[model samples]
Target: MDQGIVKLLPAVRGIAREAGEVILRYYTDTVTAHVKADGSPVTAADNAAEAVILPALHHLTPDIPVISEEQHAAGKSPPGDHGTYWLVDPLDGTKGFIEHTGEFTVNIGLIKDGVPVLGVMYLPVDGDTYAAAGPGTAVYGARARHDVPISCRVVPADGLVVLSSRRHGDRERLDKFLEGKLVKEHRHSSSALKFCLIARGEVDIYPRFGPTCEWDTAAGHAILLAAGGSIETPDGQSLAYGKPRYLNGEFIAYGRK
Candidate 1:
């Protein structure tokens, strides 16, 4: 494990939890979604969570710039040349939030040289967090540091458990993408929990043909990567960060190294 990351991870976990707390306030109220420039929904909760997370992340790692979803929507951006920066989705899954589903998350991921080396994801409603730092083992918890170290499991011979996005992508497209794969069941979830399930060994793979931003996958990517798994392009190459415009291409996540 990177010693620096070891020291940094705990502070980041606290920051994520604090941001989650901020989102809960909005969740309990009737949150009114405001559309962003890209036609994605936003709310007071997104702004509030980003405001709380951004400063604390800067405080924890003074040299790292935070590129947050809400901030980006407001045209606030950091230099593109930065090799180490934080990618934050202060509130992921706005539709789910509006629907009162407890599937949204607060995501903070550290990208270094185009790869996520650390991440923290918090589920506000339940206070569950799945996090990883550098090469250290990943962990899952509810309201505490961690309950257990998480690692991915191999695909079972009986078939595979797959994770699917709740309201994104076309089912037919996914069916086509999954043609010959043996799948026993599909678990539908929103936001970053799909990746957490891969890290927790609850699923074998997650394939997506839908559009997603860097913040949407970075934290989960890091946790999954650390938990003896990886994310890759359909062509089988590793997925990388720091791409043009922070956009993501179609990719699949596997619960194996």
Candidate 2:
């Protein structure tokens, strides 16, 4: 684990929380959604949150370039990638936020050489934060309490507790993917919070068959890895970042085996 990355957890977590607070300010009022070029919805909260995160990250790690959802969507992305860069989804689960599901989150992750080394995910509605930097650093924090350690749990002998995306993915594909597995319970979740749940051992597996960008998964991916969990393609290869247009493919996130 890089000590430099470890040292970054605190500031990154603060940045995430700061963005979450910005989102909350808009979330409390009427959140009007507008369609982007890709036909996905974007709200004032998302832009407002990104407005908070981008400069703070630049001030914190001036050399590390940031690839943020709103900026990328607007075709304002920086040219070329640094070996180390910040991936920011100021407000993930925009659909859930629009629907008032209270499942949205603020995400920040540091990717080093195509791997996520640090992350901070903040749930604005509840003031809960999940974060980590390298192995053994995973933690769950809240407004009143901060840095309570957390890790993934081994799958139980009874069955696997699975989570599926609430608004995306094909149900047929998910069912086929789960065929023959011992599924004790299945539930729907929004945003990157699925990865946080798996990181804290609240769930066993989350299989993502839907389309997602790199920013969507990076933060949660870092926290889950720190918690002794893993994310991989269905064939069991490590997921790589820094793809063209920052896109992602289908993958499965698993807790401790």
Cα lDDT, all candidates: 0.88, 0.92
Model 1 alpha-carbon miss at residue 85, Å: 0.7
Please write out the lDDT profile of model 2 over residues 1-257, one tens digit for every residue: 89988998888888888888888878755779999989999999999999999999999989999999999988888899678999999999999999888999999999999999999999999999998999999999988885799999999999999999878868899899889999999998889999999999889999998778999999999999999999998889989899998999899999997
Model 1: per-residue Cα lDDT over 73-151, one tens digit each: 7788886577988999999988889889888999999999899999999999999999998654799998755479999
Candidate 1: stretches off by over 4 Å: 144-146
Candidate 2, residue 126: how far the Cα is off, in Å: 0.5
Q: Estimate each model's TM-score.
A: 0.96, 0.97
Specify the highest-TM-score model's number.
2
Q: How accurate is candidate 1 locally (lDDT)?
A: 0.88
Query: Cα deviation in Å at residue 216, candidate 1?
Result: 0.8
